[model samples]
Each structure stands twice: as C-alpha cells, then as structure tokens.
Target: MHTPLAVEHGANLKQYNTFGLPSNAQALVRITSESDVRRVVDDPALGLAPKFILGGGSNLVLTQDVRACVLKVEVMGRRVLETRDDAWIIEVGAGESWHETVQWTLDNGLPGLENMALIPGTVGAAPVQNIGAYGIELKDRFESLDAVDLITGRSVTLHSQHCAFGYRDSIFKRHLAGKGVITRVRLRLPRPWQPVLGYLELERKIAETGITAPDARQIFDWVCGIRSVKLPDPAVIGNAGSFFKNPVVTPEQCRDIINRDPEIVHYPMPDGTFKLAAGWMIDACGWKGKSIGRAGVYEKQALVLVNRGGASGAEVVTLAKAIQESVYGRFGIRLEPEPVVV
Candidate 1:
C-alpha cells in the first residue's frame, strides 16, 4: 500500500491567478503525474470532494475562496511523438507553459504555432478555451490529449473532434468542465511550414518593416513584440489578458452599428457574421484607463481589464460588469468576458 500525498490546507492563491486576485483554497494538491491524480481519486476523503483543476491560472478570475479541492497540475514533459512527411506530432505535459512551448516549437524548427506566441496559461488549459492569437488558434494544431476522470480515475484520450472546439470554447468549458484533469496534450504541426500573417498587426509589421516575405521565425518575433506592447505583463501589472471576447453580430446588426459609427473596427468572418472589436467599442465609450475600486481598463488596450493594486476579485468583476454595460449601451452589443470568473 502507498501513502497518499499530503494536501496543503488553506492554500493562499494570491500568486496563482494572473489577475492577482486574493483568494484561498480549502485544500490543495500538486499533481505531478497520472498516478498523483489517481491517488487523489482513490483516496476516501478526497474522492468525494468536488475538485478544481488549475493550470497556469492565467485565464481565471477568482472572486471568492474556493471550496473545492484544488488540483494544481505540475506535470512536465515534452517530446516528438512521431514524424511524418505531412506533419509532426508532439506530446507535451499539461503543466508546460503555453508561451514556453511555442518558443520551444520554433527553436526545434516546428513552425505551426508561431502566430500564437506569448499566450499565457498552460498547455492543458489551451484547449479548454481554444485560445487564439494574431491569426492562429490552438485547435489548428491540436491533435489529441490524455485526461483523467476525477471520479473514475480512468484515463482517456480525446481527439480534436471530441474536444468540440468553438470560438474560445471547448468541452472543458462545458459538459466536461471540472469533471476531468488533462495530463498530456498532443499537437500536430503540419509539414511544409507556412506562416500565418493575416492579422492586422502582422500586416502592419510587414508594411512598417518592408518585409513582404517573412519566415516563421520572423512571424514569431513579430507576434511577441506586438503582444508585449499591447498587453501588460501580468507580473508587473495584474490582469487576465483580453478581458472580453470580441462580439460577433449578424450582417443586419453590423450594418446598423456601422451606420451609427462609420469608424467601427469590424472583421468579416468566413461564416458571414461580423466580429466587432470589443476594445474599440470600449474605447469609443471612453473607458480607456478608467478605474473603479482598484480595477481599471488598460490604457493601451481597452480589451484588457487591470488591477491597479491590492484589487479584490469582486472589484474586478464589478468593473467588468460596468464596462460590459457601457459597451452594450453604446454599441448595442454586449461584450462577453474571456476569463472564467469564479
């Protein structure tokens, strides 16, 4: 018989979440392997307790003390699983930093993830939100993943189709939310490496630098530089990146808004709906750099909501709600927050 790992009681979570919200978990266990999760599942005291799977805590807003047992994933490993003429399959542990994984792929000559550089969070959490940046989304490269069901202690492999990815959403955010813990993720980087450069920032980079034909490495560098300028470093300033998702509207609705504000920034999706820039709407409503109870909108980018200092999660949520209302009142489009508010 093996002894179960010791659980940390009253674990302070101030430094866990990127928003720097102050909160505590009643009990927390660090998960370093599949067996660690199984042990927790089979433990009599812990098996029945509700569990919360925490990755890098980059895309979260904790508004209250967590009553659930926190499973802080710390598993770490990365390797090329297989190489084919058409694609390269790589497996990464759940705890690997998303940004570090992107850079590693580039350093190892894997180019499919260049457009999504600098995204915060962990590899395990990527699929949950279907995180995207510049022009590429995690689903574009996601192959499959291994997850352990907390209740059954059974490990299962799920492919992209099973994940049911959507615009910044997946099963992990819906039906499977909090039901399982991801242990490993596999990404399929297609061969014949092609660069993604359709984003406005990348286009501007090309125009400014006069580099019409850039490589994957160049695109990666450009994404890193652009994000650094637009989004504040969580370490220096507390924030969950891109506090809100861009609103997508029908053509009729978009036409109506465009008639009212001709300068609105909008993009046409392949599905015919128009995606309106939430930041632009917030800025148009004059919310840039505004603060309410220690929570403020980023001066550089209104899409981001920041913690001035010693901000409570409740304050962040209140500020977010206020911004949502303002943007809705002005543009008649309700902005949805991107982070999972707890």
Candidate 2:
C-alpha cells in the first residue's frame, strides 16, 4: 500500500483556485483536525517530504509541478466571542474564505472589515500578506490568531503587534512563509467604525456629494464595486489578479523618472516615499495586453498577467520576465512579482 499520506489525490487545482490556472498536486492531504498535522508530518511515506499549506490559492500562481505534499486547511468554525451594543469580537478559522468572512460581518450589522470586501484568499493568508485595499488594512481591526508551528507541532497565539504588519507583508510572509500555519484569527470590530477616507477612489466616491463621512457598509459596497471594475472575474478569466506590487521608491528616485517623462504617474507614500503604479509603468512601457504565446498582461489592469487559455506555468514565467525587462529598461525600476511561483 502507498499508505494514507501517500494515497489520495485531491480535486483539480485548476478549479480550486479563483485564478483558474491549470495546476495539480500529486498527493494531497486535507487537514481537518489540528492533531492530524503531527501524523502527516511524521508519516513514513512523507519522510523528509516537502510540505506546503494551501488555502484559497487566490494569491498564489503555481508555476510548475508541486513535488511536495500539499496540505489543504479545511478547518472551519466561526463564532462571536464577545459582543455588546457597541463592541463586537469575532473569531474565524483560517480556512474560511476571506470574502465570506467580510460578508458575515456586514450581514450581522457589525461595522468593520466592510472596506476590505471582496479580497480573494483565506483568512490565514490575509495576515501573511497584511492584506489591504481602498484605505483599510487587516491590522487595523486585527485582534490575534493561533498558529500551529510545523516544526514543533505547538499552537501559539500571536497578537497584532507581534504580527509586525507593514505594507502587504507580515511575520508569516517574511520569516515563516512555510514554517507556520495559521489555525484561527480573531478580529475586534466596533459598532461604529472610524471611516477610512484617504484612498483616491474612495475620496472621489464620497466627494461626489461632498459628504463629510461615509458609513462602513456604504464604503464596503463602494470598495466591492470598484474592485469589480479594476480586477477581472477569475471565473471568466484565468489570472492571479495583480501580478506585481506597486513599486515604492524614494522621492529623489521618483523625481528622476518624472523629469525623464512628465507623464509618469505616482502616489506619495506616508513614509516620504513614492509609490509608482506598476500597472501604469507596464502600460507606459507598451506591455499592457501584450501577449507572448498564451500568457499576457491584462488589458484593463496592466499589473495582472492573465492566462488566456491552455497556458503552462513556464509560459507565464516567460511572459513575466519579458514584462520585467521592458519595465526596467524604460524606467530603471525592476518590477517584482507578487505571486508565490511554485
């Protein structure tokens, strides 16, 4: 016998992911119980076997055959930990789809996380990337989360401060990308949220009527509407969404590029740095919708590299390299891909 850890193969990964990118795993382990992790980790068939934790696969772009054993976190549970007329605390399993979790808050009439509506990925991966959009970040309402250390098989609690969130990055992303798997995350939300109103699109939305403040649900709906326009429906198109992070450069460096071409677009960061829109750069470099075989940059959002159909991981990587070369050659800034290429 191949043994339990070595026996089963799961669903076609092409459909499990929102990206719809064709990919597969040779051996799959769906982990429902935390204790099952220890058994899988120690399985003789998995002796020195490489391990990976998969959530919604919304943020990851699989680029090749995964020789490693893939663990699908199926842990599911959600509860209202503490609540009152004004304060609400909710805890959710990391396996919960993030978009669903956001919807749950709105349905319950609580007033946080609405601004983060429709972000694709699991709750566990949210903190890993410190997921943000519009004008709010997960860290803003974050309470804490439990993680099972793969090496020690011990569950540890991590507070918001311990997360060390900064611009689409956190502790799990930086140091424990593969070593720690999150079990659950708790978030504290207030009945009345402090409206986030700095994002340009958001500001323009509320600015239309010259409103002073917009409510959480209103802002949440707006964010969802905006993202829908910017990013393609993964069901209709196979894409990993944003292919690169908006490049952040010092003011001096930005000035050099702006001087070279006044048409260059950029946003000023709070840290006195300039966030150059990667999509704008790609489009400016004439790479938007540029196709090399079946892989290409999204026509609407240049930052997203899409698989038109019948595309392989190798083709995606090749297209990305070409885009990088073009952007770097024209602007002297190298575009970095956001997807975890496996």
- Write the residue-wise lDDT of candidate 1 on 1-342 in tens digits: 767588999999988999899999999999999999999999889999999999989999999999999999999999999999999999999999999999999899888998988999999999999999877789999999999998899999999889999999999999999999999999999998877877888999999999999998999899989999889999999999998999899999999999999999999998999989999999999999999999999999999999999999999999999998998888888888999999
Alpha carbon lDDT at 94, candidate 1: 97
Q: What's the CA error at residue 107 for candidate 1, in Å?
A: 0.9
Off by over 4 Å in 2: 1-7, 84-87, 209-212
Evaluate model 1: give its TM-score: 0.99
CA shift at 157, candidate 1, in angstroms?
0.3
> Which residue pairs in candidate 2 collide?
none
Candidate 1 collision pairs: none
lDDT of 2 by residue, 1-342 (tens): 333543456446777666666777777787765766766766677535778888888887777667777888877888899986776889998889898999888888777898889888888788888888876789888889988877777788999878889878888877877886787889989765678778888888888857667777788888898888888888788887788988999999999999997988788887899988898889988988789989888888888888798787778889989989998999999988877787
* Runs with alpha carbons beyond 4 Å of true place in candidate 1: 1-3
Alpha carbon deviation, residue 146, candidate 2 (Å): 0.9
